[model samples]
Target: MSIDITANDFLMGGGIKAARFDTIGTTVGGPITTQPKVEQQKDLDTGELKFWNDGKPMMQMVVTVQTSLRDPEVPDDDGQRAFYIKANSLKAVREAVRRSGAKGLDIGGTLTLTYTGDGEQKARGKNPPKLYSATYQPPAQAAANEFLNGGQQPAAVPQQAAYAPPAAPQPPAPAPAAPTAPAAPWTPPPGMTPEQAAAVAALPPEQRAALGFA
Candidate 1:
């Protein structure tokens, strides 16, 4: 834990406000094209690297390309290298963003750099470009909300009250009936005498239960 992190480390860590990486720095192998040759009259010829009478010095140059992450880990290889980043928004050209990605602004390209290194080193390619991925998936609904306004907070659902069957509808009130003229006083058969009538009338309810004659 006593290790100290340099500014380059933070930029390469790739999580925040300043610069972000689209590709990690890689060593693109090949030769560093030396500066073009300038011809000089040899020391009176003989025993010197020679060209024809008008042999302006010529040297063959080899080169390869690779991109690097912002604030990359310095490559251990040799030769001049250029880093490339996929544009996020054209607005990213802002100076703030440029500085963040300018960790190794030492070579040449859109931005020029002078690499003091002797040669290109051996390195490999990163699996994918950073622009190929995103940090998070914002919620779908949240995106819709954002479109409508600025942002949206999820809403809480209300608790529903328990349902009750409507009161079994009330029964209609009973209606009143018309009065009867008096059941004509029941009369026994004409042959029947008062004595007989009395005898029958005196009978107990149980004696004529079928007709309710009590």
Candidate 2:
């Protein structure tokens, strides 16, 4: 019988402690099982800046997601798997898969990872704890008069951020507003999870009729 843990035992879980961000949704037990590996992001200011830059251990990109998010600390009724690590959270899931027009980034699509407290506060004074900005979306298209709306089935997408050598074009910051729909109460879209509707009924009837799910 020996147990002792400090830091006030993590404040005894009294709740009301906001400022730990990262919990937006739209995954619901299927698609995007894995991709983007490259780990080794030791916290504590990258372990004190990798001890004067010899250790070189600050990388990210984890990216796994299975969302439902009723989240009483994620008991797993096929929900809340969560990862999507840094590099600005994988560049907001590759700009929400290029705004869902998607030329890439899929795997049972329907991403929508939002958090946006208008970001920018990683450090700098009194309370300093807000760097929220994730906002992805990607996976919505079944509007030919919504035939019982199947909408969202792209699957197998995760490969961007590699061709970067063009730096020098700053001065284009004025086009933000239009992303509000993730206060987090998810589980829609025929609300999947009969193991995501039997993995979209075993995907193959013209790829489930081109993702509209025939």
Candidate 3:
């Protein structure tokens, strides 16, 4: 009698690393087969669970993608086939998926994430957050069949249109103010005494204007 074992039986779990988007234009992408999971946030320095001031642990959503994409700074033999995304970067991917009319991200589709630029600066002396853009390409019929056939060659498929986010709205320009007539030149009243006229002349132009002398 013989026993049959599939390749997945010998696969090890854990050790998957997150992808980096440290610079502008940096991109990473892969096919998403599973739904995103939520987990407790961990402290970067100590690898301990991070908690809020009220004693509750901070939570974060994780989306893992399987791909051959590798960071140039990492070693070739690292065998890093999967990467996870969370935090603000995850928001971008969620928005893209929503805009694509998909109910959720796990559509067995490819997800591309690009670091577009830096976001608005927060408190003074603190670094600005990184901004990202995402694109989701649904799996083609040929590609799905190729996977089911155990790595067989896939048939050619027509190109699908890429998604583009709408531009930000701008504030309308202000309207010009109406032109005003210049004030008439000031003169002393004809019935005033010479002393009174001299006194009025001694006052500042603004005071005379306020007193209806202008």
Candidate 4:
């Protein structure tokens, strides 16, 4: 943050030695990092307006105006204030600039004003800094497609379809047998076959001839 001091602070910091002001703004040749200057139509044609291109306007300016914290969004008429601040009244700001050791003080950058917080002096809005900046954007360098594509090419894709797995099947069951009934009680015959009976009969006849009737 820039240290803002009051007029008394400037006096305490050290008394002023010398200061310079131009009727017009400085000439801008190439790109400027930072500098202290006020805005004015006359300042535009002054020594600071370098790299003068007649075609590109809006970018052109008398001087780049610096802003105070209170009016950062909109730069107050600091160039006008600078013009108004006379020889004796400007002592504090001049000394503050000297103490800073910088070559110049930009608008809204750093300054020692002639008022105090509790003193009779009421802050008339707020004094803008002495230094400021402005950016002159050279027209767009690339086209929309150039920005979208940069340096790369589009990727390739396949035409064939993808493979899928087959589905599973189920199994069948067996048939049942019929139930059987219980058997009844029974008896077997004790008699012999017909052939055995014939043999016995013939033997009996032979025996009967020998003995009495068989």
Local distance difference test, each candidate: 0.30, 0.44, 0.60, 0.30
Which runs in model 2 stand beyond 4 Å of their true positions?
Answer: 1-40, 43-78, 86-96, 99-109, 112-214
Worst 10 residues of 1 by lDDT: 133-142
Model 1: CA > 4 A from native: 1-18, 22-131, 135-157, 170-214
lDDT of 2 by residue, 1-214 (tens): 1123334432332231222254443222223444324444555544542322776666544444555445566354445354535656466666666665657544444444445444555667744332333434323331221223445443433445788755668856669899898654222254454545555455445555565555
Better model by lDDT: candidate 2 vs candidate 3: 3
What tens digits encode model 4's per-residue C-alpha lDDT throughout 29-108? 22111332222121334644233367332221111222222324435423222222322324444554455554444432
What is the full ranking by TM-score, best candidate first? 3, 2, 4, 1
Best by TM-score: 3
- Please give the lDDT score at residue 205 for candidate 2: 51
Residue lDDT tens for model 3, 44-104:
8798988989999776555556666665766763423443445567788778777766665
The 10-residue segment of model 4 with minimum total lDDT is 137-146
Q: What is the lDDT of candidate 3?
A: 0.60
